[model samples]
Target: MEKESGSMKSSSQTRTEGSKEFEFTARDFERVRALIYKKAGIALAESKQEMVYSRLARRLRATGISSFVTYLDRLEQGSGETEEWEAFTNALTTNLTSFFRESHHFPILAEHLKKVKEPIEIWCSAASTGEEPYSIAMTACEAFNTLTPPVRIIATDIDTNVLNTGANGVYSIDRLDKMSPERARRFFLRGKGAREGQVRVRPELRQMISFKQVNLLADNWGVSGPFDVIFCRNVMIYFDKPTQGKILDRFAPLMKPDGLLFAGHSENFLYVCDEFKLRGKTVYELDPDRKTSSAKLRRA
Candidate 1:
């Protein structure tokens, strides 16, 4: 009884540090930011400190805590506040991705799939709310000229709520406004009544992809993959150097030797000299046989 009480007291002290005004300091933001980067490969700026705090503030309030200091303390102390951690990570992480968000990338995907010889597997690492992955699937259907069993997509996200929504493959009308008219008509089913003007991705596209909850930081990945392509766009900016390296190292084995990797326009391989070889400006080719090098690259 005494030992358990002491442990509880120590936990309380740790949490108290976070709950105090001192807990939400610049240093605390940096600590949380670094942890997020390490865990999710999310790159965030100090300017986002307020965003993190404010978003988390609402969550803390929802949890019946009024002060960030107390909230920070609860977060740090693990005072049975696992929901707080999930809320923190979910709110801080960006999910700005959309269906065919970067329309330009689809042609690249089509071109790559045209060359794949084996069972084609694609991983949409930042597949948010299912749009992107669904787009990939529909693109595959277009690429192959038919829906075949061989084409598959694995879409993963850190947020369960979004994962559920993605798996549902539903979206509002406004979000669908950007989709090309032909694609929109073919791909979306118009909802009515309470969901009037909203849309859901057609079952054909939704069926081709599998959705799962994944945190990039957790160990082992519990996945066996040798993908033909990995769409890891817009995900690496949140991570620092070492975290980026570790993720790439893990990413390499999941990709085939000649597999293609696509990243967001904002990300680059300029600083990452190892793990993956540059295939093009926004794409990489995993070359495990080649040692990591600072090799000059020009498109063939």
Candidate 2:
């Protein structure tokens, strides 16, 4: 009776595991977690197993690979950079952004822009689909009361796919529903005829930003700074505390003494790095006591 019961339990477990098109064992999930962490500094939680499977399953089908093992092996064994690797990273990347996301930050940013007399340099560290950077540009324009603000924004992301979308500067008109109609009309050109239901950002806003592919985990971010503002919102939550500290340390040298760092609503930089102090809400400024000469010199 005991042996029969054990066999039935094993059979039930097998049926459960077999429900999906792909065989995803716990070990496969661990491998994915480790690889993504190494590649992108993203610390995937255990709860993400199903999400990973769902996303990668499409990659597996697209590549005509029969199993996760084979698909992962191809990625692991590949030399240097490959299209598949890019696809893999892009697939796993979660891009949830909208025009003027974290709306409160924009008002603070506008206030800061007004205080600075010099031409401004801003870095939108995760420019996903271009909305954030364009919003920044729009804010700058409004602060200065002109279509052309003396601001240059470097918008970058690790996912080249999204970088391409950002550079295109086109989106469905509905994406603008939250903005005041005047703001929307001022910033976007409505599509007509064949392109109905879409809107393109004004050329001035698009021109203010330069899009690039940047991996925060990389030794070199491929962009220089002395930036007045760095918008690193929502991107750090994916990284472990140590990775977040290292990135914050790197950010310190690249910013002016009075420069501001904008973090996500839930992110608190106070515990992560000592270089910055809370300025307001999620905004951070260089710690007065820890100000470095490089930062001061950068401003001069």
Give the TM-scores of the predictions, in the order they appear. 0.82, 0.94
lDDT of each: 0.75, 0.91
Give the C-alpha lDDT of model 2: 0.91
Residue 150 lDDT in model 1? Answer: 65
Predicted candidate 1 versus true structure: per-residue lDDT over 108-199, tens digit per residue: 88988888875888988877677778888988888878755468899988877778889998888888777778878877899988988788
Q: For candidate 1, give the lDDT.
A: 0.75
Question: lDDT of model 2 at residue 197?
Answer: 98
Q: Which candidate wins on TM-score? A: 2
Best by lDDT: 2
Candidate 2 lowest-lDDT run of ten: 291-300
lDDT for residue 293 in candidate 1, whole number 0-100: 27
How many angstroms is residue 257 displaced in model 2 relative to the true structure, after the best TM-score fit? 1.2
